[model samples]
Target: MERVEPMPLGGDVARRADAHAAAPLLNCLIREVAQRCPGQGGRRVYRLPGGGRLLRVREGRRPADPEVYTAGAWQRVGHTDLVKLVAEELRRHTGLSNDELPAEMIDSRDAVAALLAARDRVAPPADPYLRSEQSLVTGHPYHPAPKARGGGPVASWLAYAPEAHARFPLVLLAVREDALVEEGDTAALDALGQAPPGYRLLPAHPWQLDLVGGDLAGAFADGRLLRLGTTAFDVWPTAAVRTVHAPAADPAPGADLFLKFSLDVRITNDVRRLWRHDLLKLRRTDTAAAGAIEAQDGPAAWLSDRGYRTAAFAFEELAVLVRDGLGGHVLPGATPLLAAALAEGFDGNPLDGPADPAVWWEAYLRQVVPPVLNAFARHGVVLEAHLQNSLVAVDTGGIPVQALFRDAEGVKLLPDVTRAAGWERLVYCLVVNHLTEVAAALVERHPDHDPWPAARREFARHDVPEIPRLLTSPTLPGKTNLLLRWTGADGADARYLPLPNPLSGP
Candidate 1:
């Protein structure tokens, strides 16, 4: 008779020990497993028997696997039951109650080893996928029951993975209508099997279309089809509306408008409400204040006060849904500012640096600032004024003449919340978030100038003077980052109100 060798503890037990250290729940599970199978390999190393200490467990066969086992099977132990078993075992072995183990012991490696030993005894759970109803819904043909469609000589439709679900499987099928042999046979759903001569079916990658089948359909219907690349889109609604390009054919054109959905609905709603409330407050109380400031100072102050406004458009208002054109104008691509610079470039690169402040100043005075300011003053609203949110379109002279504010959802009103909260939020969004990023980009282009200080001083002199004092001075009840930092012109800092910088050309 052949003798069965005793199973030695597996290497996987150590790995599980390490993993359980990082996860509290896993530790509890291990303890439970040990309690259930007390005879299974279980060992604790206090001091080493040899030169180096070793924690080891003797191998034990599980009833389910018998000879070989997997880590996944061990992980299926119920957490609560595991805890109870470990407590009972501790009482029997140490003559102490379940609660007697120090809190530290629960997190220790020794406890983890004990738990793994216990898990070795329990049988793993049955595969959940085996229980699903759609097991027959394989890469099969879309054959409706007899009453639904043509039964004989039906066309073939290809089924592709639409999305992957750990729990539920889904597939996308593009039925080619042109492939149908029967004419005027709308009722023959099964007639369309294969793709037609001129038509093709394109299915999204499983990873790309994962959790967004409904959203994708809605976007296609609404014609708002720009979406982020796989990585970015998965985490946030940061898509650029554009057409996809095909290698062999002419470039697919895209739309001028872009839409970004909110990842967190609460955050989106908060921003929208904030904008509305600020607009109401500004229209009622700040109109005169803005006008007076503009008159006393200049166009820069005036435009800064007005900001950007939001308009709800009817579906008919949209022009063509140009397919992938936005790829050319995306950020770090051919931005409006860069386009203008290239048109006026002294060298080949558009971002060789502005030729003169006059060109920049004129554009700001004539085009960029005024409309934005006028919009806010007239309509009592402001769009996101941050660097990334606002696009700078230049003209032939390499001057920033136009500003296109994207991400309509990030737009908010000025001076609506309590003074302190409003100022902090505005500064954080505008100066810290937007301006800092833009400054960094410009600095990358213009290595010679300490762009940050210059921009800070310029902002102080032209837009908001009080920023310097706010950053450098003692913290007021709610004031933050107002006096100490160079508000963006240079060294000269002064106390001033919150306003857009005049010289911030685009």
Candidate 2:
């Protein structure tokens, strides 16, 4: 066996030593050992050519023996090569270098692959209740009935009872074969046995059906239509859908929970577009768009299933219709907290007293930034930490406590496939997209505060305590292009901030 010597752990030698420095050497050693051993799981301690030992750790959870080497045994190894090896693997996998990474981690190659695979295989959900032309004329017979008490008579002969309420204008019952009904319509009320005194029935318009698109199966599967009492509300339909009041008393205990869909598909579309763009930028062009979709959705669903504070909805497609309603009824004082901060605008200062730069900085560092950093460190995921994308939920006293991070479409695995692409994008989103925007807003609001310096100090103190390099980093102009555009600045005046490379331990 070729003997290897572990480096000494003091002075300049210790400073240069890292887990990764040992990876190439360990990898070579492991290959040699595997050739000799040919086993699924095993551990061996070998004395190196140097005065140290190599403790090989092999895990057999998978078909092949996954091996890692720690240079220790005789004396406690202060600078284990395993750290560098893992760090390198992390960089290869997520794009973040060791300095940009979190303090802890949950490593599972299969889990990571599964998540990546899931992003590519997302199919739009289905809605079983929708009416198709072929089904309307052929499978189910449609019987037209006289419009109810307050409503006009049905205009189409094909309108049926259970589905009759699918038409619009609940009060008039103006029958259009395809007109869609609101969740709180009288026809739905009648089905629920809670019809109001002046309830009316209506037929759906044909044009409305055309707007609903083809198969309802996908919509239903995707959670677009949910049952409320006896009526089904269009939860995530593509078009602009609205909710109206029904005269009946609340049916379910939690009936007060109003479910409104989103109007702009841009949020979801942006997520998909960004995800694909990032993947392509990282040179993972071989991975299909389906892969990206699956990767994004899998973690989203996982997080939702695990009960994180995500915007309460199912798919990105559903976000269009649901977000507005969710936004409307956000816990009463929550909007004001966010609005107060956003109203200040985005500039280059951070010390505006009216906005309490200290308070904002503290809250963000202690509460907001930690969770996000922790998530990345522990899970290899960088959440969408942008201002507009995040919701600041506060208590009745107006003190910000909990942060509601929405738009899962933006959450990505750090240390993405390639080194440069993943790291740059992660830095762009975290530092530029989220942090810089907020910093600019703070600075704009408080012109005298010198926002950049304060922000650097704050980030250094909390997010990357090990690396103080952020404090001395120069500004990047082109990088802050988004902020400049938002600030309505032209060319020369916009100040861009450049972040220091993390590894140097600034």
Q: What TM-score does model 2 achieve against the real structure?
A: 0.35
- Candidate 2 per-residue C-alpha lDDT over 1-506 given as tens digits, one digit per residue, 9 for 90 to 100: 11111222343332322221222223333322222333323544443322233344332111112233434322333223343443444344334444411111111111112222222232222221111100111000000001111121222211211112222221212111122222211222223233222332221222222223253345335543321232332222111112222211333221222122212211111111112222223222212221332343111111111111101222212221111223233444442222213322212112233456656655544444555545554445555555434444444433445554443434556455343343445455556545654554555555565544444555566454322533444532124332222233443232434443322223
Q: List candidate 2 stretches off by more than 4 Å.
A: 1-355, 395-399, 414-420, 462-472, 475-506
Each model's TM-score, in the order given? Answer: 0.31, 0.35
lDDT of each: 0.29, 0.30
RMSD of 2: 25.5
Give me the candidate number with maximum lDDT: 2
In candidate 1, stretches whose alpha carbon ends up further than 4 angstroms from where it belongs are: 1-209, 212-255, 261-349, 353-382, 414-416, 444-447, 450-506
